[model samples]
Target: MLNGCYLTPPEPKVITITKPVPILPPLYLLNDIALSHPPINTNRELLKFAVKAHNQKVLCNLDKAALRAWRAKYE
Candidate 1:
């Protein structure tokens, strides 16, 4: 039986629409991996760790500023 149909079904009409994906931010960043390793399970441990991290961050900033100042002289 001869059927009057195209050799293959026509490709679906693709309508490409760009949509901005909405990213939902985390409710709490306390669980972020960047915060620390060996995740803390106790409030006391977390507080101690947080204080250490804060001090390290301040030291890192000072080192970065010193490096930038030295680099600026060469540039």
Candidate 2:
């Protein structure tokens, strides 16, 4: 018994669109990983950690003016 079906590979010119991925600082990822794995069970602690992660992400993505503002705020 022979079943005939043609399978074609993807064309060399095919374009793949990927989602915009946020780039996080190494420090940011390390901090998040450290916080997320802790045995602490307090809502306040968790919220603090979330804020840190979000702020770090925002800082990573800031434009020139935003970066200046952030620097001014911190320094």
Candidate 3:
């Protein structure tokens, strides 16, 4: 009975918790726009095409800027 009392269980060990790694979101692809062909016929058509092209360019640039911002945040 004395020997059984002396045989005590061992102390519990300390467990260390590690920090989880950050996960990056998947990149989305942009679709290609159907551009107008050159003949352009009249001044009005040319102006319309020019404005549309400019808008598309601006949108593309915005997307690039957003991607850069995301990269900066992750890195």
Candidate 4:
């Protein structure tokens, strides 16, 4: 007897599990919300055509109060 009774070896089992990620809300929801707001729609259109320096792209907000004050002085 060699180290307790030894029979056939255990079989090898390979299990493969794959997980997927979902990108939610979909395109239709985005389109609907975009249509609901006028300012957002206008901003989106402006972004499509507005061109700025490569380093300053996507930065479009300005200080309305300061701009109004400056314009008032000139008026």
Candidate that would win on TM-score = 3
Tens digits of per-residue lDDT for model 1, 1-75 = 557663887899989999865443333421222345468999998898888998877776676666555555555
> What residue pairs are clashing in model 1?
none
Give per-model TM-scores.
Answer: 0.49, 0.30, 0.51, 0.25
Clashes of 3: 0
Q: What is the lDDT of residue 26 in candidate 3?
A: 52
lDDT of 2 by residue, 1-75 (tens): 334565677778977999865543334333322223455489998888788777766665554445455445544
Q: Where in model 4 is the C-alpha error above 4 Å?
A: 1-7, 32-75
Better of 1 and 3 by lDDT: 3
* lDDT (CA) per prediction: 0.63, 0.56, 0.72, 0.43
lDDT of 3 at 24: 53
lDDT of 4 by residue, 3-50 (tens): 677688889899999986443433332221111213435765656544
- The lDDT ranking, best first, is 3, 1, 2, 4
Candidate scoring better on TM-score of 2 and 4 = 2
For each candidate in turn, give its C-alpha RMSD to the true structure in angstroms.
Answer: 14.6, 17.2, 5.1, 18.9
Candidate 1: 10-residue stretch with minimal lDDT: 24-33
In Å, residue 4's CA in model 3 sits off its true spot by 6.4
lDDT of 1 at 36: 52
Clashing residue pair totals per candidate (backbone < 3 A): 0, 0, 0, 0
